[model samples]
Target chain A: MLEIKNLHVKLEDEDKQILKGVDLTVPAGEVHAIMGPNGSGKSTLSYVLSGRDGYAVTAGEAALDGQSLLEMEPEQRAAAGLFLAFQYPVEIPGVGNMTFLRTAVNAQRKARGEEELSAAEFLKLIRQKAATLKIDSEMLKRAVNVGFSGGEKKRNEILQMAMLEPSMCILDETDSGLDVDAMRLVADGVNALRRPDRSFLVITHYQRLLDHIRPDVVHIMADGRIVRSGGPELALEVEQNGYGDLLAEVG
Target chain B: MADTAVLVAQVPTVEGKVRPGQAALAAHLDALDLPRGGFSRAARQDAAQRLEAMGLPGARDEYWRYTDPAPFNAARPEPLEFAADDATLFTAIDRLHLVFVDGRFDAAASDPLTAEGVEIESLAAADAGDDHWASGLYGRLEAAGQVPVKRPFAALNTLAAADGLLIRVTGQVARPVHITYRRSALDADVHLHHVVKLEEGAELTLLESGVLGARSNVVIEADLARGARLHHLSAKRAKDPKLGLGHIFARVGAEALFKSFTLSVNGAMMRNEAVIDIAGDDAVAHIAAAVLGDGNIGRFHHDDTVFVIHGAERCESRQVFKKVLKNGAEGIFQGKILVKPGAQKTDGYQISQGLLLDEGSQFLAKPELEIYADDVKCSHGSTTGALDETALFYLRSRGVPRERAIVLLVLSFLADALDEIEDTRLREDILGRLEDWLTERAGNPGKA
Candidate 1:
């Protein structure tokens, strides 16, 4: 469902290369996890795929379902079924959470030439989805992520993912700041949305989150390249020791 | 030579050399052909004298530094004969309609001026007697407001008003009085002066909307007695090359409440000045304005100058102003809160903000607080900033289009000022108008 070929990204203002000659692919109906030490360009990889500003794609191609994602605008990418669950959700002071979700949902639908959801329909759907994530109407009514706890913001992002129902989801360190209970809830939310056609690229430094979501494949990323790929047990091998042994062996 | 010197000596001496625009105002006043002996001849003569002495504001004047008053003093534009389509802004509730065309009352289009506990009289039909309630108020507040500063345009309006109304409310008014000013003539220059007096415990709401005229000068003087309340809202939407100048002078009595809000959009040049006096103890007053101006270079300008005076103990005053400028549009906000020596326990808050859509746009704000009272709490803030890039990115990443995301952020920037509107329905109406304006601009490239 997702493909990246020789992806090389550099900071726009500086001559610093963050992603260097990386290749990865996530097939449909499969979950892929990328685990690496700090400064391995894990977050940069996720950002490059999502089309964020301040990063120049020097030489590479990123495609989703045979369509060139790099050529599309950010919103177009979202409409094309690319969802990024941000590690730190932005705090929008005046845009209410509910209003934000509804606008996003309708905007994507409109971009795809689909009939917009009515307000009542949106409210009902959002309420049912929010209930499972433990988000109350009060949080939904407040400004988007303003004064929200770490867990609430993550859950809200997941709720958006559920509502949009993207085909390719990128979870960028979604478990970094979450407690055990919050992580369990988030994992449950993601697990529930797992389907035959949906795929997830889980990027993290720890293997704890993968325990709940259960990735089908694991790749050890180092020096802006995928160093190795193996089954789920590869995660356990690193967890038992550390990336020090792997980094030494790769060098 | 001796005779000429004597004649020149007889002429009044101004503070400085008369500006070209100021010298032309006398000629313009002659063309207006003001009538005599309507409400207060003395008030008219005093105002005319003051206008001549003060002259028109010049670029050098401190108060007029940011805003050029030349257009307002220039020759009036030829009338716009475009008939107003049925675009009603205040659809929240039914209201008593009053129509003015080219600054003249349109009796055929207006509803009959009749309501329980309210006596409304047109300035043309007002009793000329000195004992009338309006006589004491015709231009009294304007004169009183000029103590700390001078407003020559307000004085001009008072001196040469062609038509307006006098309203007296002694009880609760269920429906708001909606005044719609229409422009039917291309060469119309309108000067209207209105007076409103609310008796003790009375309540009233005044709603104003429309394009007043090609060149218009309007003054509204309201006096609220003890425990009385007045709500005033005006929505001014004028296109390019038209000029609108308005002034409001209100006196809030003991335990009285005075709240006023204005929404301005798409004017070549527009200035709304509000002067409020909290005279009685425990009185409350709030004045807010939201202005949107988008046009070519030097074509759009909006100025909101507000002054609130606290004269009694424990009085409260708030001034909130927000402006959205795009495409070289210019916005100016000048507000002051004054607490008198004996007016202790006064609570005053002032905030002025501007959101410039591009580098070409400009915003200038001067927020002032003068407190002679020792035991008062007063704060003021002013800010000018571009849209939050992070917020914009967040919205866009969530699938909202770039244009819609900008609109949402702009609306959020204006949310605090809109909350000052006491009525939710009316606030929503204003919000809807803003949204429509933004949506239209969104479709036009290079506007955002």
Candidate 2:
């Protein structure tokens, strides 16, 4: 459902290239995991795909179900069924989490010419989904991530994905700050949202989070390019040997 | 040419006949012949001299940058000929009534409450013997620097103010007193001076409402005693699309609390100036205001300036101002706080936020603070931005439609200021008016 062909992006006014000829594709009913060391361009790829500013797509194209994703604005891309679970979600003061989620969901609906949900219907839908994710109703009433703990904010992002139910979802370092218990809860939330027609690209630094989600394919990235691709056991091998073994092999 | 010359001979020069407004004001000042003792009297004379020297504030004056007072150049409103009948105005605000018509107190409309150890009487009736605080504390709150270069209207108010309210609370006053200055006549100018003395540990709340017609100018002076607390909330809802100006001078004693909320919803040209002085340690003062206008309804201006003296340690002061303008309406917020050398541990915060509903609307916010003390926490922020696009989109996405979303967002933007009012009844009343204004805009969306 998602395809990126020889994607190259650079800082707007600088010669430094952040993403150098990166290529990836994920078909329906499959999960892909991209593990990389610090500054390997994992976060940059998510930002570029989600249409955030300050990144110039020098060459190549990113398409969702054969539709161009690079040409759309961030909100438009969100409406087009593209969701990026930000590593550091913007803390929006005075905007409640439930209010923000409803706005985003209804905005996408409006863009697609669908009837909007009433307050009662919205409350019912969000409440049921939140229960499965173990998110309390009170947490939804607070300002969007405004004083939320690290784990709660990540869970809130997943809650948004469940509400929007995007065609393609990108999890950027979702496990970076989670404790063992919080990581398990986050992985469970993501697993529950998985479907046959939906796809997820989980990015992380450690193999611990993968123990719960169980990706079908695993890719190791080094220096802005994918260096190796293997089955789920590859994650186990990397966990034992560390990125040093992979980096030496790539060199 | 002969007819033109004859008309020129018949007409009086600008200097010979005081512009009708100026002439009436001069006559009122001459009639008062205020004694030299009281600060109100001395301040009046000083303001008059400054008015004579500086003249009316025109477009050229930096302080009058957004609004032009020249429209008031034509006819000066005389004090109302008859006592103002305030039955209609008093009903609008549900509280104990204190009525002042044409700058004179009306005893018939006042309530008798002596058991609470609170005295409410006209300044004219106040005795000099036992009412020592009234005379001693009166005019003690001095305006810092040279008194502001007087505009003609202020000079006029200083000159004409006569009998107003003198509220003295020996103990806590449970109920708030509603002071209504109702202007029914077309040409009416009322000058008012109010003295409020709260003995040690006393508390009082005063609600001021100004309802006036065409050509009205008013001024007020207030004083608060040591260890006392006072909250003043004033709202001006003027009709006739004429001119109205109000000046307030207040002094707060040591360990006292003074809080004020001023709202200007409709006016042709309205200016509310407040100068407050914090004289004692542990005192707190808060000034909050909200103004809204559209069309040729004129401009609303507020100047809140505070002066904190030395030895007033642990004093706190804050000012929050918000304005919404549309259809060429203009709003201005100019605030300043000065901290003296020994005023350590002072906490002062000021914020002014505004929204321009249309391209033609304008807002100017200036917050200035001067601190001489070493250990002080003082900060001010000003934000001038259009409505949040994301917020609007979020609301519209919920099937609320675009116009309803804008109304809700605008109301939410103003909710912060409205939430500050301690009285729920008054807060709801203001919110209801705000909703009505928003509804009117929603009904006629095209005009905006």
Identify the leading candidate in terms of TM-score.
1
List-wise, what DockQ does each model earn?
0.65, 0.07
Please write out the lDDT profile of model 1 over residues A1-251, one tens digit for every residue: 99999999899999998888889999998999999999999988888788778889999899999889988888999999999999989887767888889999999999999999999999999999989888899999999898988998899999999999999999999998999999999999999889999999999889999999999999999988888888999899899889999879878
Q: Residue by residue across B296-346, what tens digits does model 1's lDDT show?
A: 522788889899999999998999899998988899999999899999999
**Candidate 1 total steric clashes:** 5
lDDT of 2 by residue, A106-224 (tens): 87788778888788999999999999988998999987787899899899889888998888989989987889999999999999988999999999888898999999999998888
For each candidate in turn, the TM-score is 0.92, 0.65
lDDT value, residue B73 of candidate 1: 69
Candidate 2: docking tier: incorrect
lDDT per residue, candidate 2, B240-350, as tens digits? 344666666666778898888877664446666667677788888887887776654444343333333334789988878888767777777777778888899999888
Q: List the pairs of residues colliding in candidate 2.
A: B21-B76, B254-B280
Indicate the docking level reached by candidate 1: medium
Which regions of candidate 1 fall more than 4 Å away from where they truly are?
Answer: A37-39, A220-223, A228-245, B1-22, B75-86, B127-131, B446-448
